[model samples]
Target chain A: MVKTDGLHFQYPGGEAFDFPNIDLSAKDHLAVLGPSGVGKTTLLHLLSGILPASSGTIFIGNTEITSLDRKALDKFRGSHIGLVFQRYHFVKSLNVEENLQLRQYFPSKLKDKERREAIAERLGLKAHLKKKVTQLSQGQQQRVSIALGLIHKPKVVFADEPTSNLDDVNCERVLGLLKEEAKLCGSSLVIITHDQRVTEHFKNQVVL
Target chain B: MKLGFIAYKNMVSKPLNMVLSLLLLVLSVSLVTFVLQLSKQLNGQMDKNISPVDMVVGAKGSPLQLVLSSVLHIDSPTGNIKLNEAEQIIKHPFVDSAIPVSYGDNYRGYRILGTDPAYFERYEAVLQQGRLYKTTFELVAGSAVALKLGLKIGGKVVSSHGLAAAGGEAHDDKPYTIVGILEPSGTVVDQLLICNLKSVWDAHDHGDGTHGDEEHREDESNLGNEEGNDHTQENERHHDQGDKEHDHTPDDDEHHHEEEHDLHDEEKEITSLLVKFKNPIGLVQLPRFINENTNMQAALPGFEIQRLMGLLGSGVKTLNGIAMAILLVSGFSIFISLLKTIRERRQELALLRTYGLGTRKLLFLVLFEGLFLAFIGFLLGWVLGRLALILVSKYIEAAYGYVLQINGPEFVELLLLGATLLIAIIAVFLASTSIFKLNISKTLGDA
Candidate 1:
């Protein structure tokens, strides 16, 4: 579960933000609906502990993540949180399956091939797992990003505008796949996006 | 999925940058190693060929040339010295041994050196085939000479007039017969065709080119040493008498034989003498005494070889400097490549950082790339250096008759290997400082 109370952020240049409280349990989902430049990405970054909150409490289970040091927070984020961004990223030298399995290397040195195959099969990425990500279609590449995020089985999946670059068909198909895969892994889903269509599928919502 | 594999793949991802840097690194390291090996081998060869000679007494000329020709046998002789004067120097109390050397002829560019049997003892040479030559005009061929010429024990060879392979002027009248072959000595002795001193005098100074019963009988005995039969000697003398080449025939006169014996003791000339001293005092005093008192000049090989190495050292030093400059340039190339690549792949690094790969792991990834390059550079450079020596050693053998020993990497080359890795470590660390300051939030946000 992920929870945040009185989350406030202040950049070194004095730009500040005050956020509302959020509480979500395992297998629960939330849509952070907002337009561009309204702190949607900032809230995701603060909740994930990528950027420190000025005066706030953020928890990924019983652990308050903001109080951890840089190294410990990195490890905590790796094992507990999954991040998927809109601009697709993959190690160019690696194939699709290697890119997905590489995420497990951050928190744990052991390989988890059963989870990798399960995620690939559910997302319709099973056929293209051995191919280079560059050779895949844009939709397939976005699905690979999802596999990379959840291959380690984190506590909550945080995706930033994952469906923003898709047309109507792919946009709803990707949003549906994200929620379904999060339910299969028994993890909370957080889709932070400007797309109003995502709010239709996710009943639990927050306007940042 | 290993970090090491990622590091390797990322390093080779830019083939242009990796190949450009690796080529220069390999060239510089190979050149430096080759120069060090060649210079060390040259010094080693000179020291080995010095043997036990304290001084060389030869005709007046450049001391370097005297040392090069008499001691190393790689240069032409500086004319001939009188045998009588050289024998007088050998009679001095400080002299332990003096081996008279006379050579002005070659068989296929292999020198036919005339010296006493004590010359073998100086180099510790042993017979590989047959017995030593106990008479005049019988040859004991060196291992290289026999192998190159396909010479057997009973083979006869006629020499040309000069030191090199001259076309005409062949001394076909008095051919020398191979009586023995020396084993491989790893010295200058391995390249010569050695015979008794009388062989040279007979080839060039046999008066009137005629022979009598007594002299012709002695010739048959020497020629038939391997087969000591009276019937064979009679047949050999009879066959030679019919060929009109019975030891330089001129009108078939026999009276000049006695006058030639007179010429042998008084007017016979030799090129030089390898003089070994009984004590260290002669090394300091003998060369000066022979130079001031006798008509011959004395040269100390140890001093001359040092000067020769000094002249060669300056050239090797220049090549080493150029090679070092190239190595420095290669270090900077790798540094700039890693640094520029780290900046260009900022988003990729940001993704890795966001996924909880620590700054230390990122640093190690970059360092592993450098380690891979250094390992390949040193290994290939070391092998290329030795392979080049094998090729160049052929040329060295032809020019100087000395084969440079091709051994494995010694202590100095291991130090070079150590230095190559150190350069990579320094370059990688300098390029990796930005990895610590990477902002995952800002970099991922920018994308």
Candidate 2:
């Protein structure tokens, strides 16, 4: 459950832009579509509590993130939100299994072995779980990043350009895995992407 | 904590860079260690070189030079004074005891000292062989002299005509019988030969020895009837002319006794005196009294050692200062490297930040990297410094005859090293300000 009322943000030394008010609840999948420079990623970052809003009241389960200090906000984000980046952001030195294990560094109750195996099975990453992130193919790394996003079973998953690097089939597989993991955890999914192909999987759409 | 380990792993990925940094740190630390150890060894040798004399009553000269000559055996005596003057000074009310040392002969570059039984007692020297010199020709050799010359008790060894072996003519008939060997004290005495004052007199006494001054008769007579072993190799080649020149045998017995006493009083040949007061408190007063009242000077061991430390310590401090500067520069290098690394990993860090790592945790990651490098380099340098000290100790002991204790790095050293690491880590954190200012939205958009 999340909501933002008149959320506004601006790059430092730039004019502020206000985002339209929006709301989402359990198990709802929202596709955020916008041009490259229209702050699609900014909205996702703000929703995920990774960026401060110039003027906003963002709520996740009735708690305003804008008022929290950097430390408190980080703890809040770790326990409640899972983020998937456009490019594969898996640590270069770690294997897919280790990348999944990184989720445990946050305050979470996910069992390392169980979460890794389940995510690998769902995303078809089981065959390459022990391979270093750098050693994986671009498509495989993207799958690993999506797997990492769902490993902690957060209440909400925020994806920024999640399908940009995936091919047609890999894109479908990545989106399918994200939706399946969200449904399994009773979590809502919000994806920001310039690619129009990902819109087919989500019932809800918010175009900027 | 997990992030800290991750940061450390990433920092060590460039093994060559890590090794280069460690090598620089080791080089600087080893230099500091070497200089400190050398100064320590030198100071220790200075103390050990000064032996049995409670007071260095000698002709006016630099006290340091006198100490260097008489105790260290490194220089010649100031000038010869009468033996009676030394004896009278020794019998003074405040004087506890005295040893008369006459210097002349050398065997293979080692100084040969003619001294009395008091030299042995004052130095707590033990005879390792036959006995102390019972007669004029008997000699007591130091451990090094015995070993280097291959001489043993009861063996015969000849003294060169002078201090140098190459220039001095051999005094074959005036051969010395090695009657005793001194136990090793790891001091300057280990490189000398100790004989009685009469032996020094007899070696050059033309009547007893075939080799005597033949040419420089005027110089010998200029000595004012004072008996000395100042008979050099030049005198040996020239004393033939003086073979029958001054007939001191014509002088009356009482006049000769008075002449001998005055000669002994005038030929004061002590290089330096090592004076000690009944109490350490007398240390301050005695040096002042000696410096102001007489031509001779006195020096307090502690004050002189401190002065020497100050003079020598400046060089050491300058070197340490350079080391510290390099350490600081390396700290900045580490900081810049880690900060640049974090900036390059902004998207990755932002991803982690989104996953609950805050600005503080991200900053901590960079800080941990800096600390990790410093800690490793510090440990490496400490071990390297100690190993360098051990290697240098052997060479110093052999060269200076002073046993240096190279063990025991004090707590202050460890504290200083720890502080250096702490500063390096802080520098890394400071350099990571760029990472702290990273904007997640801009980063993700760029990615």
TM-scores of all models? 0.89, 0.74
**In order, what is each prediction's RMSD in angstroms?**
7.4, 6.8
Every model: iRMSD: 1.2, 1.9
Tens digits of lDDT, candidate 1, B1-447:
778988887877677877776887888889999999999988877887885677898888778888888888898776577788888988989999999998867788888899999999998999998988998889999998899889999999998655666442566767899999999988888989999887876565433323335544543443333322222232243333432343544333352253345453445678899999999999989888878987789999999998988898999999999999988888887788778878877777878877888888888888888878877877887788888999999998787677888898899888888888889889999998989888888888887
Best by lDDT: 1
lDDT of 1 at B36: 98
Q: Against the true two-chain complex, what DockQ does each candidate achieve?
A: 0.70, 0.47
Best by DockQ: 1
Per-residue CA lDDT of model 2 for A1-208, tens digit only, reads 7788989997789866778777888778888888887888778888887778888799887788888888888898898888887766766656678778877657564556876797789778899988888888777777787777878888888888878876898788778878888899778899999999987777788888
How good is the docking of model 1, by CAPRI class? medium
- Write the residue-wise lDDT of candidate 2 on B172-270 in tens digits: 657888999988776777778888776665555433333335423433442222332255432342234333333333223443333334333243344
Candidate 1 TM-score on chain B: 0.86
Docking class of 2: acceptable
TM-score of chain B of each: 0.86, 0.70
